[model samples]
Target: MGQMRRRGTVAAGIAALVVPLTAALGGATPAQAATSCTAGVGPYQKQAEKFLGRPVDGKQSSTDCTSIRAFQSKHGITPAAGYAGSVTWGVMNLMNQQKAAGKTPNKAGTCPVNKGRIACVDLTRQLSWIQDGKKLVYGPVPVRTGRDKYETRTGLKKIYWRHKDHVSSLYDVPMPYSQFFDGGQAFHSVGVSMWNPPGSHGCVNMTKTDASKYWSLLKTGDDVFVYGRKPGT
Candidate 1:
């Protein structure tokens, strides 16, 4: 078994690609299939339909529920009942925004340009990337940051430590490519999907590939600029 582990489950993150839902769903869609799903119009029915490419009629239908519920289940959202509530819509909304974020996510100039070889973490977009004096060095990949009470602190920090096979001292979970920059908070790879609900315990969770890339691209004393407030936080 791989050492990588999330606090809850791995089915939603990288492992999801290994298990295709095609055969089980009769080739419907990994994110839009099921025999049973919630019924009735949800609070964000129209918005969900727009995001999922479903017919944009405000009323909820069986097909819409199936699609929405599948998306919920895919992202590890609670209920997975296709309610199209604020929580579900919120996730979809962020995804839509991310898609709109084209080549330059830092075009807003929020991250410091003077910092050489710095990692930029935008909690509002739930994305992270590296830059070398205005030039994009690495990815603008999705990430999972600390939620609610355990919010990831916003400010500039430096990677103080690293451990390839680090295990969480408090949660007892494997945190691969762990790079600590703040107290109990690091950029590590977890099994949970970046879009998974609630969030991490004040750590910046990445995919194994992303974390590995980050590990190779970043080093001790590398500046990490974190800004913006995560929605619902």
Candidate 2:
């Protein structure tokens, strides 16, 4: 009976070792694997296509993955790892559904005033756009404007200065693609995650890619309209 008990104990020890080894060899579990954007036909693929401004075909293509990565990067989606997984799908779904429901801007009054080219910042929506007459040239891209005490000034102003690489003397921070409109306040690229917000001092913060695009389109003397109070004042 004592000999039998010892054999059983040895068997149990081997079983425990086997389980962990099998798990390690098998790699990520189903739940962890599901986080990657697999290439194939699926509803998530269709949603990702739509979010990327591609046709919603329910089929995954290389273009779709690239665009998804771009969107993920812009929105500060992590693993920013170019996978349209659960988190990516969730963010895209929420934003796309909201846009479909007309929560996004179609037009702003200031867009038509310039007639040539203008950048309009809608504080209420935390969105910014570039327009020429009635034609939208660029965004409805997300932005982080100044918070309460340092509220970004309202009213129309013209781009008076631009620096492809600028450093803030006052704050001692790098402000790449800085386009100054209202005094010290400028539209510049920020490296910090803009997803969960604290807010900027008095500048308009954009992703580096968006800021570069802005620099390419806007020149000195371009009109910039800062209007609408941020939601909840």
Put down candidate 2 lDDT per residue, 45-102, tens digits, no spaces. Answer: 7666665567887766655554565556555666544465766676554444224323
TM-score between model 2 and native: 0.58
lDDT of 1 by residue, 1-233 (tens): 03333322222332242233454245776345644667768889999888777899898877777777777777888888878999988987777666555458799999999989999999998888889999987767778998889899999999999998999879889999999998789999988778898999899999887898898889999999999999775
List lDDT for all candidates, in order. 0.80, 0.66
In model 1, the worst 10-residue window by lDDT is 1-10
Model 2 alpha-carbon miss at residue 191, Å: 0.9
Model 2: residue 117 alpha-carbon error in angstroms: 0.3
| Highest lDDT against the true fold, candidate | 1
Local error of candidate 1 at 162, Å? 0.5
RMSD of each: 5.8, 19.3
